[model samples]
Target: LHGKKINNHTANEAINHGFALVTEERRSTGIYAYLVIGFNSLISNIRNYKNKVGLLDNSRMKSDTQWVIDSMRVKTPGHRTQIGSLSGGNQQKVIIGRWLLTQPEILMPGSYTPLRA
Candidate 1:
């Protein structure tokens, strides 16, 4: 990673270098099935949404959630809806969008087959 030798303890260091990996089991490991869509959209990047006072910024979360929904083309009634209710494809989209917010230089997705070449 950027010429630095990465070790098992340096996982965060790898991530800091713009590395992202999406899990193969999206339903079982990628998403919180009972949580709302907005939660799923922001959970991966939640640390960035903290304000100066150590509180979450709701408006910012909402905006970013909307971005995930629109940019990922995830079809859901609203952010408050439980993510488990969505189709499997849509859940994967949310996972991808979650990682995209980190602006990773390298994205490795697991167990994927495109419908078209």
Candidate 2:
């Protein structure tokens, strides 16, 4: 959390400092499969979408979600599509996109089988 110690803060609060993690058991922990891709894409950084009066900035959320879809090359019909409909790899892309949207200073992705790169 930059130079600040984050010992007492809640997990969500820690996100404000641009730190995120993608866990090992992605199927169990990473995604809300029944939810739309748009929802999943923005959930991590959802608080940032609020307006001064606390209304959601839907257009911005959509735009960012689209950015994630396009940039990550996540093969989905659209943002409204359910995440469960996608293959495991594409789902992982969406999960990664969610954290990338936060412009994270540090990202820790857990033990997924490493790809040949």
lDDT per model, in order?
A: 0.86, 0.87
Winning candidate number (lDDT): 2
lDDT for predicted candidate 1 compared with the true structure = 0.86
TM-score per prediction, in order, is 0.89, 0.88
Name the lDDT value of residue 50 in candidate 2.
100
Query: Model 1, range 1-117, lDDT digits (tens) per residue?
Result: 667765535757656778877889988889999999899998867889999999999999999999999888888998898999998888888888998988887899999644221
Residue pairs clashing in model 2 are: none
Which ten contiguous residues of candidate 1 have the minimum total lDDT?
5-14
Question: How much is the lDDT of residue 65 in candidate 2?
Answer: 96
